[model samples]
Target: MEIKDKVIEIIAEQAVLEPSDVTMDSTLDELGIDSLGLVESIFAIEEAFDISVPFNANAPQESDFDISSVASIVAGIEKLVAEQKA
Candidate 1:
């Protein structure tokens, strides 16, 4: 699956929702995913893509990766994947 699709699936699993229920504009808050869920989702994303996410749970806003929205997270993961292959 594509990075976006896989990310959505992972996030959906964490939220106990279907992939169709998730959208690019969806935020973790909108999905009712707590901090622990967010961290778990990040870990899943990293493992799925075999890429390390530069996210800081304590200071998320200060991190290089953007987790503001599902689209942003997907974009960040795509970037990391591309960089890793380079």
Candidate 2:
């Protein structure tokens, strides 16, 4: 699957929703995901892409990774995948 689609699927699974329900503009908070769910989602993404996310759940604001929105998360993953392939 494509990166966007796969990411959406992962996020949706964490939110207990379907892929169709997840939008690029959707935020984790908007999806009703708590801190635990956000951490789970991050782990799922890392496993899915075989890339470590630079996220600090304890201090999210200080993290290099941007989890502000689904689109941003996808962009971060895409960048990480590209860098890994390099």
In terms of lDDT, the best-performing candidate is: 1
Off by over 4 Å in 1: none
lDDT of 2 by residue, 12-78 (tens): 9988999999999999999999999999988998899899888887899889888899999899999
Alpha carbon lDDT at 19, candidate 1: 98
Candidate number with greatest TM-score: 1
* Candidate 1 per-residue lDDT over residues 1-86, each given as its tens digit: 78889999999999999999999999999999999999999899888888888888889999999988999988999899999978
TM-score of each: 0.96, 0.95
Query: Which residue pairs collide, candidate 1?
Result: none
Error of 2 at 21 (Å): 0.6
Question: Candidate 2: misplaced stretches above 4 Å?
Answer: none
Per-model RMSD to reference: 0.7, 0.8
Candidate 2 Cα deviation (angstroms), residue 24: 0.5
